[model samples]
Target: MLNIPLIGLKADQFRHPLDLEATNTLKQLPGLDLMVRQLLGQLGEQFFMLENLASSVQVGENQLPHLHQLLVEACKTLDLEVPQLYVRQHPMPNAYTFAMRGKQPFVVMHTSLIDLLTDEEVKAVIGHELGHLKCEHGVYLTLANLIVLAAGQISPLGTVLAQGLQAQMLEWLRCAEFTCDRAALLATQDPRVVASVLMKLAGGSPTLAPKLNVDAFLAQARAYDDLSSSELGQMLKQAQTAQLSHPVPVLRAREIDRWASSKDYESLLARSGSVCYDGETKTKGGWRNW
Candidate 1:
């Protein structure tokens, strides 16, 4: 299999505008980044490391070679360094990444996600998680997770801060997922493959995955766009997604579908051959400077 690498791929090339806007607003918050990194980043990293190490199966050449190959391929396709991959035995289909500026980063996938997706679909999931790293989302992401987990235990001032930041963080997180979905498309070079993964996640199981129809799911995505065109429908849509960390699957499917057909995606593919690999590696080691 000939792999056409997206050499020199940068997150900005595909980052959703909403993600950029939300991230810019979040960064304007005075000392919020420093405070979160100083107060909770390292501790959160340790907590997740311990949790995954105790319960998840780590992927390597010696174990789950096929999935490991998918990880490697996705990393190369996106021009990113490979992070550790762990498969946890959970019935729900989900995956997430954890990374820090100067600490080792990793992605965890629920075992059920693997069971529900084919090798190509699984590659899309891996690519999506790698997107989080490529964009350096880990710092604030960890802080968001920590805030949600420890909101009650925080001091009154801290609670107020968390309350204010949580909505913004959640909004950013949702937009970030859109950017990652584009990453998945870049890695697979197949929009339907990415859309199928979303469709499956919306409602898929090991038994039903094979029977599902990607075309129908995509049509449904379009239908959703039509339904949400009215003012009342738009408000309902906002209410449906305001509290969620990821955009609804149909919305994601529609977004990817539009991007896949846009001139931007076409231009990107045409330019892929000209962009040579820079041979830079993304690895974290020193904690003192962080």
Candidate 2:
């Protein structure tokens, strides 16, 4: 693929508007930031780092070189430093990232997720996780993860407070996902690739993924939009998603389809230079080696 490196990309240049709004609202809540960072930050970071190092296979030049190449290319394209990448043994097809101040950021891809996606789709997934880092979503994201873990163990009085915080965190998380989808698109330079990843996640297994159609899935996304056109449908939609951390797969695919053709996406790429490289080896182009 002829990929472009967004030489001086900024998160705001492509960040979804809803993400910005939700993040600002999070920022306005007094002491939430300080409390999350000062209280839970270091412990959470250390714990996750140790857990990954112990249980996950870290990707690098000598190990899982292809995956490492994907990570390096995506980071170069997004103008961000490469973080550690780990493949963990799990049945769930999911990928997530962790970043916090004074800690080495990292991304984890479930083993099942690797089996479910094509190489390009895998790259898009990496890009999506990197989006959280690009936008500096570490603190709130760590808090959200920790909150879920701690919610079940809290005292009765603290449960109410935890629930309230969890609700807001989930709302922000869903909005944040849209922005990450955009990042995936930016990294892949193909909306179809990003949409395909969503489609597979929605209803696909290793066997089913090969048979799924991106066009049909996009049609289904449009249907979903129409389904929510009525007031009751809108309410039901809200209720269904209120407690969820990520946006619905179809909704994310729809957002990517819309944003990929937008002027903002085009303008961002227009200002950048393309690199001539296939998925494997890099070739010469109008890009600099970072």
Candidate 3:
């Protein structure tokens, strides 16, 4: 894996504009931020951490060594603090992150997900999760998780607040995923790797993964983008994703394709410094001037 070190990586460098707008909207809510942290942050983090410790396999140099190397290399490329990684047994292929202040943050990947993706693709998944921590999406992400989990028990007054905030938070979360997809692209330094991961997630199983064609899947994404040209089609598109936690897979593929060809992506890559990976030193020193 090529380590393209972004010496002073900041969230804004890769943050999706929609994510910025939605985050600003959430911040505008009076007392919402403080209320979320004080009310749910502490207990929610503890619950997730304990659950993972009991149910997941933690990765380290001595365990899943190759996967551990990917995580270390990606963190170095993005200039992020390496968080704990855990692989949990599950049939579904997926990954997620839970982070909080004053506590150890961690990323969890399903066993099936690792089974499906290659080493570079796995690194992209790891980078995508790290983007959440880099962007501080956890506070709101936890709140959204809480709302979904407790929606049935929330009081009428709490329901009113949740109803209003849920829509906004869901939208923000979807946008946040876009930013993380970009992070995946940066980590892998290959747009095709990011798009391939999304494509596989859309429908590829262990049986069909080897037969799937990435070029054909990308063409399908273009067709999907074309479908939104009409007004009714646009509405249909919005309706299809209205309640989704992440944007539909084709939309994500399309976004990465566009960004990969954009000047912004080109400039960022041009400005980055490359680190050669050897057995003795995991990464060589390099820094971005601006």
Best by TM-score: 3
lDDT of 2 by residue, 72-138 (tens): 8898888788899999999999999877663578999999999999999999999999898888788
TM-score of 1: 0.85
Error of 1 at 38 (Å): 4.9
Question: Which scores greater on lDDT, model 1 or model 2?
Answer: 2
- Per-residue lDDT tens digits for candidate 1, residues 199-280, read 9999998899999999999999999999999999999999888889889999999999999999988877776644433654
Across 232-274, the per-residue lDDT of candidate 3 in tens digits comes to 9999988889888999998899999999999888877776654
Question: In model 1, which runs have C-alpha deviations exceeding 4 angstroms?
Answer: 29-35, 142-164, 273-290
Give the best candidate by lDDT.
2
- What C-alpha lDDT do the candidate models reach, one value each? 0.83, 0.85, 0.83
Model 2 TM-score (2 dp): 0.85
Backbone atom clashes (below 3 Å) for every candidate: 0, 0, 0
- Regions of model 2 farther than 4 Å from truth: 28-35, 142-165, 273-290
- lDDT-best of 2 and 3: 2
Root-mean-square deviation per candidate: 5.1, 6.2, 5.8
